[model samples]
Target chain A: MIVSPTRRRLLIGSAATAAAALLGGCDALVDNQHVARVLEGAEALNKDLQRALLSDTTLAREYTEADMSPVFKANGTQHPEGDAYASLLDNGFADWRLTVDGKVDRPLSLSLAELKQLPARTQITRHDCVEGWSAIGKWTGVQLGTVLKTAGLNTDARYAVFHCADKYENTADGQYYESIDLVDAFHPQTILAYTMNDQNLPVAHGAPLRLRVERQLGYKHAKYIMRIEIVDSLKAIGRGRGGFWEDRGYEWYAGI
Target chain B: MFHPRSRSVGKPSSSDVAGATQKKLVFRHPLLVRLTHWMNVLCLFILLLSGLQIFNAHPSLYWGKYGADADPAFIDIRAYRDGNSIRGETRIGSLAIPTTGFLGASEYNGALSVRAFPSWLTIPSYRDLSTGRRWHFFFAWVFVLNGLAYVIYGIAAGHFRRKLVPNTNELAPSHLAHEIADHARLRFPKGDKARHYNTLQKLAYLSVIFVLLPLMVATGLTMSPAMDAAWPWLLDVFGGRQSARTIHFISATLIVGFVFVHVAMVLLSGVWNNLRSMVTGRYAIEVEKHP
Candidate 1:
């Protein structure tokens, strides 16, 4: 039972391949509607691999204030120039109320003051954009899990969908929104951040409130959150995909 | 020197030992070398295509930590609207290169689509970052493992020391100059001289294997947020994640350049022999008479 180094290496490689194959279907995982659909299984496999390797509670890297980038560029749309949004902005978002509904036992609307009074956690974390850039900034907000618990999620609820104030290009269904699974929804760092860098979250950077799923990419952090809707399935969402960008070719799960 | 031709079931002939004038088939690359080489070729191709797909999401390259649509970029490939049509250009600082055919804008299904890299060159052949990422990561695992195996085998078998490292005599300024001059004139080595790597080939192979490949892997890992927690020193080593990405793109470009030159050289200096050497580990080398 002597194995040469090359043979041993090949054995290890094959074992890895076997594990991946077991996790994913060998054949086409999804129909080739989009070429990306073909990789649905691989994405699932990766998700499983990451989950198996690290605990769900494992936190993303937190940096010191000194490590913060001099300038944190506001991503995506800077402002939404609609009358509703304009009036909300003009009044310093005082009239804004984040409605937590959909698949929740208690559908409650909480004002900005009410959210601020809740237990808050301040963190300095890096925002890694899928576009190959990173910036660190201090965020202060209430844990999303706390808010969800207060809202009393229905047993069937599997995902938390965050509806945002910003729109992408003013299309017919232009409301920018994003969602996360329960696993990420209740993660310790997952928060609805209302403040950035000790100041109220600027209009340029998702003023009033923003979803900060630290483990995921910048896109997953839906800005200017208008509603927090817990849903049983993402099938009926925008374009029947999980998120706005996810509908437009981005990965629904951007944990990496 | 263990010619694979001799191992054929038909048996060896007296001609196996040539009379010293004709060509002789030499066992140049080993089984492990060939396997790793081919595997790397596949992985590198997939990685490159998938990487391009990822890059298409934001067709811009920056220097420091923060970069977005607002910030100044060193390289920006953009496709913009004109009167009733669209055109694309790759800008490097002030110089704009019209790269409409292949980059920035390219033909997708007979229609001029604003794709940074054409469909033929991307893994998914469409804008699917998730699928592209999955392909990239899966092949990346293969690439890293294969590379590890290759490096281990090279060290254990003394392949690097024997074949890749330039000897002291070859390192001599006069000899190095001669090698450079020979390569410049497209004059490749033949006969027994061709059996061993020339100084330039040795340098190229060594640099690619030791420097560029490792750098690509490191920079890639550095860009991963998970890896950032695992190995924070990666950020220090490459300045930051964004800087690592910039380095990764540069390294990939260099590797692509290397592959182009490598392929051209293979075609220039006996494609069949070189191909055979890598494939079946048998390279027919010239045997000089009365040398």
Candidate 2:
């Protein structure tokens, strides 16, 4: 077909305009609560599928020291801003204690030294960030299962919520928290890592302690853990979404 | 009364009158194929846009097991401040290219912002990685399910064997060369020839359906840590999560290239006819006339 240049330009211009309008419409859809809820429904599907397909014994791919990244990037809160964390850092975390309470048979507060003494397990694993970068580091810590066993999880405990010291920037509550189901909480590879790359876990990488849930994204690995609360429901947690990032729209089940 | 060139062709039917070319309408696409094709169109459109939004979260690609800010990336899209101006730069190893007003940096909400991809290219047209992911995964499910249905229908119904798979003669180097020459000259097949997909078309469609699309899905799944645990072999197959991510990006780029060529071919061959075939399952082709 033969078309005049002017007519072709008009058609192209209208097409561009239409595309812009479509984009605007998409933005509106993004903000719509109903659409957001429907999209969030995939999280349950992914969680269920992964839970059904993977055995509890299935471990995340462990790497050799040679496979580790030369430099592991410190993401999110490098140094928490609080008098409690500041004093703990000043004393080399000597006074810092991780309290295991809430829906546990025995509530206990264990010091860093005590945590290190609770049968340490070391494994080199990759840390995948939600922003599409990865870093592999060797972590040494006691398995969460061991600690949960020591404290004795209550029969009704459906989830283990990790409350951290560092507050994510821009968040109204300023609390960094994450939660995982019983299957992941008791996973053999899931550990409370206090050492990274054969050294004391640097404050930049979440000093004192960090939860390393290997099967999930980095955000699920709560850092500078101050408390582990066993809970039947996450409705009372920060914004009731389970995690700090989750409250901000990140999927609670970040298996993907 | 017929032209000399038409004498050697097939016998003219009642539709051919006064030596004029005759047009025949055929049901080109099946109902299932048409439905799946349009669904894929929607899925791919949303997936690409949302995928770009997700990619913008960390605008870099790398190799091997792990990659982050400290690690060197093969492709890095970032912006740097230059006195009064901000410069968008795309760096590949030793080579650096200024890509202002586009990659690395672009205007968002009337102000120049640092982002890997421009706002217009991404879904929501904003920097919401969470929402972007939601859109991507939701549409991705639709895409995969639709693709699975199409493939099953194609195989069970002989669509792949009869329509997509090129014959031995078409596979010959000389025939392929002729088809390439014809395509280059914009000489599309006519009449009965147009009823079936050309050899080039068959190969392109087959590769996209069987190879590229599957590769995309596999690589995408490899990036998921949960999937990695459930199926450790995916990590071995892709060489690592980082490598899988890079492959996924490359495959998406190739798919985009295919879409461009596919659209161009449709426009060049016969826009309305191609559109009708896909949308309404009807196509018009000129009939070869004979004396």
Candidate 3:
């Protein structure tokens, strides 16, 4: 009838264990879901601690030309294959239009030249990959904040989901995609990069446009971007997670 | 007095009239030391396992700013096809050594797969980067905090100086050679001499606590992109992010070696006594007989 603090803690722990057992059956590893959940709780703590300790206004370290890597290896899929992508590549992306819809007040579709026509900023920054490699390169593009302002973000929009043309692992439902919260979305260095190394973005490096989230890892920089959708929740996205790699067990907020 | 006061050791009481001496039990480890030691054991165990899991995601070590699939790495662990079967190998640049049961190939889900570092060695025992990172970051905080507590308390209570720092006599080449010779022969000091740490123990403990642990933590922070913006000096100090990672791996490997020797010593000397000293802060000291 009476439960001490330690006893209560034990009871709660056992309850969690029981729930984990039920969920573990669906996963490959035993008790993985429960363990993952607890770990995610810890990750949330880390996220909050980092956000509080780090200023949002602070910029990522900018490098000089000398620091750039001679060859920035293309991460993930280098080139996307398909008739539609082939036609877009043939026209030099002349007819390609990036759709900005979802929770935006004014849904707009802008061409590649139009995005380049906007005020452009170029900076050299290191692209630190989650796979334990890094490469510095000069990226030129319009600030994502500038485009978001022009499109007029709705009051309730919380995240910017990037729909890309790249297909990862042949997931039939859609192409490779990624998302970021408003905090990273408006960061000064967060740009829709259209050029790499003073040249138009190559096919291997996400031609046309790509997201440049300087504060995060390489996977967060969605390549071959086709559309930008503002939304309140990521519940309806790929596997109900933020990005392609995220859905495949990479951290959603990969600041590290 | 049987022993000198300069050594800070208790002299066994003896009366010549009756020729009787009472054996004494000295408090070996303090409560703080015992608590931190056990805490370190748990934290370090989890941190090491989780760290291995994280490393399995990219089983390669490079020495520069940029190193990937195309670039040659100083260390690489991968599984490749050999004839008709898949074989695992660990390569150090041009040298490829078979590591079928360990590094490159491992048993997973009751079947031999291309899992790096084996399943038993990892926390989740599966190829899950997110889960590995979560476990790693969680235990890393615990490990750091436990280390800090041990360090602050060790300095404040003179634990480092009194127990872990070798004096001038112990630091002498002759004395150090003797200690090293004794260690090579599996000989440990007993009675009064066993009451405090030896010169070799002092050096190992000092380096691990003061040097290696901090370097591991610093190099880890340097690998973080966000931390680069917060503290750019980390990159400069380590030369590059990838170099920091290699350093981190080397430091962790050294710590693993330390743990092996530390445990072996504990078992070789007296497992029960050593464990009791760490857990309950009590150890039975061997008494020496004098004529």
Candidate 4:
């Protein structure tokens, strides 16, 4: 059947617009699995690019004492909601034991008390939130290396995973967690801070103890850390990359 | 005409080290340009820092079609869930400068994000969104005016054609491939034209100049409620406010990424020569063979 040119053109235009509308609305335009793959690829490429282009230990520019923002907003869940988390918080986190297990010769579970006893490093570092605010505070905590050494990381271990109690529910099954490479994990300033501004870490500020990997963005500093598992690969963990956040679009290594 | 490849190929740039008379070259970043650049930089820095704070509010890509489920780490997904799927499209609280005019007199809402530090630290309490809007708006003027003046001066002074824009032959597919290879290996060419930007520089600069800056301005305007009163078409232009924000973030990330690459290139392609050109406006060059 012969179609008129004008009618054909109209049909083409309508089809194009319909296709675009479908792209803009329905999930048919692009596959969810493909979307996942693209994100995963971007995540992998970004990690390689970061490692190749950026120095892992290079610190984000330190601001002057004067540049410090007057009010430091506390973001993320202000306080954990679960009863298990509540019990830990109720006891002043004294009973909180940050375990360093997995691929390590000596698996050790140190109480927040024991963590505080180690040789600590204090830095008046600035926390550069991805949200666009900057705050400077004195963070004091034991170096992650001190604990890594205490536990004696296995030669095969490559990444240090921080499993936290904070379950920011996308579902009941998945939980919030993060990880880091050995270099960032062992950097002198990278500590499991128990004190902030000369006080025991407040619940609002990732208490009992929170990570202060002084240089990276705040998310890498996993709050409410329950255990540190040293591993050879991230493949076995959630989504098989690194952190739960890392699994879901956030760069596994968010170096400042 | 001269050799067709001459434009693309090596040029015999003058130098004093060859026992010749001193060379003369002039360039300068005017006060307005410098001020504009610094202001834009400052804006970007703060935006990134504060934006990170709101990432936890929610972490989902509610982009066109293909938008999917959440994978842990995203905040409040279960609370806001429907039909057994969490809406992972926007951050919990939209990324905005929270504390504008309420500075120094505000109390806590009890919302504490590890990354989202309180508005107090960055945005002073009681200082409301009005002040944030001011800094953001005024600085935007600096960005726009500076860009305009730069374009004008760059063209009038031959800086645009001579320094910033790449020659025609550089746009070739083969040339494009080599430039990519060079960028990957960090092997920047050397000479008078070498100090002159390669294809990548031209592409990146042109994209930022013509494409990105405009997007920033458009998106900034689209986000403003006042802008709706001023111009109704902005909503149509960006599709919607949420879409504008998404594009703005994505483009800003691209620009910041470009800055990182640009700086790295400078370090690789003789930091001293590049630094000299930028600071003193005389990029030292390796004179090619005068065959």
Best prediction by TM-score: 2
Residue by residue across A219-244, what tens digits does model 2's lDDT show? 99999999999999999988999999
Tell me the spans in candidate 4 whose CA falls farther than 4 Å from its real position: A1-31, A82-84, A130-134, A170-172, A247-249, B1-291
After superposing candidate 1, which stretches have Cα over 4 Å from the reference? A1-38, A48-73, A76-92, A99-108, A148-159, A165-176, A186-188, A229-241, A247-249, B1-20, B79-88, B94-115, B118-120, B123-131, B156-158, B288-291
The per-model DockQ list reads 0.23, 0.60, 0.32, 0.02
Find the 10 residues in a row with the least total lDDT in model 1 chain A.
A22-31
lDDT of 3: 0.83
Q: What is candidate 4's CA lDDT for residue A175?
A: 74
lDDT: worst 10-residue window of model 4 chain A: A22-31
Which 10-residue window of candidate 4 chain B scores lowest in summed lDDT?
B64-73
The CAPRI category of model 3 is: acceptable
Native contact fraction of candidate 3? 0.52
lDDT of 2 by residue, B195-233 (tens): 789999999999999999999999999999999999999
TM-score leaderboard ranking: 2, 3, 1, 4
Best by DockQ: 2
Q: Is candidate 2 or candidate 4 better by TM-score?
A: 2
Mind giving the per-residue lDDT tens digits that candidate 1 earns over A1-256?
1234787688669969975753343123322455445445555655666666546677877778887777887888798778999999999988999999999999989999999999999999989898776778999999999999999988899999999888876787778999999988888899999999999999888888998888778999999899989999999988978888888766776756
